[model samples]
Target: MQPVINYLNTNSGEIINSLGQHLTISFIAAIIAILIAVPLAIILINHRKIGELVLQITSVIQTIPSLAILGLLIPLVGIGTIPAIIALVLYALMPVFANTYAGLTNIDPLLMEAADAFGVSWRFKLFKIQIPLALPMILTGIRQAVVMIIGTATLAALIGGGGLGTYILLGIQTNNNNALIVGAVLAAALALIASGLIRLLAKVPLKYLTFAIIGIFTLAGIGWGVKSLEFQQQETITIAGKMGGEPEILINMYKDIIENDQPQIKVKLKPNFGGTSFLFKGLQSQKIDVYPEFTGTVLQSLVKTDKAIPHRPRLAYQQAQKLLQSQYKMTYLAPMQYQNGYAVVVRRSTAAKYHLHTIADLTQFPALKAAFDPDFYQQSDGYPGLKKFYHLHFQNVKTMEPALRYEALAKGKVAVTDGYTTDPQIKKYKLVVLNDSRSFFPPYQGAPLVRTEFARSHPQIIKSLNKLQGQITTKQMQTMNYQVTVQHKKASQVAHQFLQQHGFLVQKSSKR
Candidate 1:
C-alpha cells in the first residue's frame, strides 16, 4: 500500500495527463455513438425490418474482439487517437441504438394514440410525447455506453493512443503491482463518475437538458481542436518501443541522447508501445519516426527468407540491415553489443527434476506443460521452429501474456517457457536457460530502426543515435532491467545513470 502511495505521489502529473486523454477519447467516442445511434434508432422505430437489420449489424460488431478490431483498423486508418476513437464508437453503438429503438417502440400505445387523435404534428408526437416518456430508457442506454467506452478505451494505449492504459501495460510487463493498482482504480472511478453524471442529466428539464448536451459537446470540440492544432505546430519526433523493461530503458536512453545532442528537436517517448508487428506497421505508415528492433526478428518475422538465417550476430545484423533497406526502405542502424536472443527457460527445481541441460532434454518430458507468449507461439523462429528442430512437444501448452508467463512458471503452473536472455525475471526466479545445442534461434541484437526518408532528412539524429553502437552489454542490460523491474526504479532514471556513467552525458554535480 505504501509503495502504491509512493508511486502515485511520484507520478501524479503523468496520471493526470493520462486521465485527461482517457476522458477525451471516451467522451468523443460516446458522443459520436449517441449522435449516430439514437436518431437512427428513433427513425427506424417505424421501420421494423431495417431496425432489426441495423441492430443485428451492431451486435455483430460488438462481438468482435477489441484487439482484433484495433489490428484491423491499423492498416486502414493508422494508429493513434483516430483509430482508437473509431473502434470505441463502433463498440458503443449497439447498446445505445437497441435501447433507443426499444424505448421509442415500447412507449404506451394509448399515449401515442392520444397524440395522434388530438391532431398533434408528427414532430410534437416525437419530441413531446414519445421522446419525453422514453427519456429514462434512453438515458439508461447512454449510461451503459459511456461506462463501456471508458473501460474499453484502455486498449487505446497499445496503438499509441495516450491514456491510463500506458501505466497498466507497463505494470503488467514489469510486474509492478503499484502501477497496476493505480491504473485500474482510476479507470473504475472514471466510469462511476461518468455514470453518475448521466443519471443527473436524466433529471433535468427536457429543454435545458438538450441545451446542456449541445453546450458540452461544443466546448469539448473546441478544446480538442485547439489542443490538436497546438501539437501540430510543434516539431516532434515520436520514438516507440516494444513491451518489456529493456526496451523501455533503451528508448529512454535514446530519448536522452537525442535530446542532449540536438536540443531543438523534441522527442516523444512511447515506451511499451506494442509488439514487433504493430511497431513495424506504425513505422511503415509514418505514424512513428523511430523505434528499436531486433536483427533476428526482422529476418524471421518481417523479411521473407527461403533459407535459414546464420547464428552469428554480425551475419544476422548485416542480412537484416541489407534486407530492410532494399525491401521496406527502412534503415537499421548500428546495433548494441548485447544479444537479447531467445532462451528456453525452466525453474531450477524443474531443471534438476527433469535433468534438463539443453533443448533436446525437453523431449523426454513431453507431458510437461509449457506456457508461451502469443508472439512466440505464432512466430516462425519461435515455437514452430523449436518444435521442428528439437522434435519436442508439450501436451498441455498455454498461450499466455508475456508478463504472466514468468509468474506462471514460478508458481509451478508450467514447467517451461520461452524467455529473452536479458529478462530480469531470469535472475529473480532462479531459472535455468537450456542451451540451444542445435543453434535453432538466431542472434537478436538490438538497433534503432527508422524510415529511410527520415534518416536522410535528419542525419544529425542518426549521428546521435549511433553513439549507442556496441555500448550496452548483455549483463549491463540485465542489471538495468532488474533495477527497473525489481528495485522499482524509473527506467528514465536508470537510463540517465547509464548514459552519464558511459560519458554520453556530463555527470551532475552534487549539491551540499
Candidate 2:
C-alpha cells in the first residue's frame, strides 16, 4: 500500500497526462469505428448478405488475443506509445462498431414512418429521431469499449508506452504488491469515470459544447502547470531486470550513487534489476538510455547463441561489442573488474550431512528442489546446457527471484540455487559454493550498454560509465550488497557513498 500510495502521489502528473492520452486514443478509435460501423450497420441491416461478412470480420478481430496483437506489432512498428495505442484502438473497435450499428438499425420501424410522414431529411431523421432513440444503446457500446480498452492499456507498459500498466509491471518485477493494486484500481476507476463522463456528455446541451471546450482547455493548462511545478527535477531511468543476484548488486550501486553523493540528479531509476528481457525491449525501443550489462550476458542474449568454447573476459567483451554494434545497433562499453556467473550452492547443513562438495556429490541428492534466477546462465548455461554439456539434471527445476532464493535455501525449500561465485551470503549463511569442476557456465564480465547514436554524440556518457568497471571490485560489490540486505541502507545511499568515497561528484553536488 505504501508503494502504491507513493506511486500515486509521486506520479499524479503522469497519470493526468496519461488520462489525456488514453482518452485521445480511445475517443479517436471510437469515433472512427462509429463512423465506419454505423454506416455499414445501416447498409447491412437493409442488405442481409453483407451483414454476415461484417459480423464475421469483427468476430475474427475480437478473437485475436490482445497480447498477440501487441507482440505482432513489436517488430513492424517497434515499440512505444504509438504501437500500444494502435493495438488498443483495434481492440476497442469491434465493440463500438457492433454496438453503434445495432443501436441505429434496431430502432423501431414505426419511428421511421413517423419521420418520413413529417418529410424529414435523412440528416434530420438521424439527428432528431434515430440518434435520440439510439443514444442509450450506442452509449452502452461506448461504455463497454471504454472498459475493454482501459483494461488492455495496462499491457502498454511492456512497449514503453506510459499508462497504469507501468505500475503493474513494476509490481510484478519487484514482487511489490502495492504497485499492482494501484495499477488495477486506478484503471478500473478510470474506466468508471469514462463511463460517467460519456453519460454526462449525453445530457449536456448541444449549445454547451463550446463551454465544454473552454473548460477542457482551462483544465489542460492547469494540468500542465501542476506538472511543471511538481515533478520539474525528477528523472526516471530503467534498470532492465528484476532478480538476478549480481545485477541487483549493480542497481543497488546506482541507487547508492544517486542518493548519497549526487542530489542534483533526482532519479526514479526503474525496477528492472532482475531479468533483462524487459530492459532488452526498453533499450531497443529507445526507452532506456543505459544499464549495467555483462560481456557474457551480451554474448548469449544479443548475440543469440552460446559459443561452444568459453573465452576470457576481454575476448568475450570484444566479440560481444562487435556483435551488438552490427546486430543491435548498440554499443557495449567498458567492463567491471569483477566476474560473476552460475555457481551451485547448498545449505551448509545439507552439504555437511551429505558431503555435497561438487557436481558428482550434488547429483546424489535427488529429492532436492532447485531454483534458478530465470535468465541466461540459469536457463541455458546453468541447467539445460549443463545437462547437455555435462549430463546433469535436478528433478525439480524452477525459476525464482535472487533475493528470495537465498531464504529458499536456508529454509530447506530448495536444496540448490544458481548463485554468483563471490556472493557475500556464501559466507554469511555458511552455504557451500560448489565448484563447476567443468566450468560449463560462460564468463559474465560486467559492461554498460549505451546506444550507438547516443554514445557517438555524448562520448562522456561512455567514459563516465566506463569509469566504474575497475572501480567496483567483487569484494566491494559484496560489501555494498551487505549494506542494502543486512545493514538496511537504501541502494541510492550505498551508490552515493561509494561515489563520494571515490570522488565521482561534480562541484554542483555541494548544494545537494
Q: How much is the lDDT of residue 29 in candidate 2?
A: 54
Relative to the unseen true structure, what is the C-alpha lDDT of residue 477 in candidate 2, on a scale of 0 to 100? 78
What's the lDDT for all of these models?
Answer: 0.89, 0.68
Model 2: residues with Cα > 4 Å off, grouped in runs? 1-52, 199-202, 206-291, 304-311, 355-361, 364-367, 371-378, 388-408, 419-438, 474-494, 508-512
For each of the candidates, give the backbone clash count.
0, 18
Give lDDT tens digits, candidate 2, residues 1-512: 56556656655654566556556555555555556666666666566667767777887888898779877887777666667777876776677667767777788899889889999898888777776777677667877887888778777766656567766665565444655687778788888888888788777664474498578768867977997776675544444434323454566455444443445444444432224665676677766676777777777666765455265667777788888898888888778787766688888888888888776677667667888887634465667776676666678878887657877888888888878866767666778887777666777777778788878965644555665766777677777766644443445556667777877654324434
Question: What 10-residue stretch in candidate 2 is worst by lDDT?
Answer: 266-275
RMSD of 2: 5.2
lDDT string, candidate 1, 32-58, tens digits: 999999999988988999999999999
> What's each prediction's TM-score?
0.87, 0.77
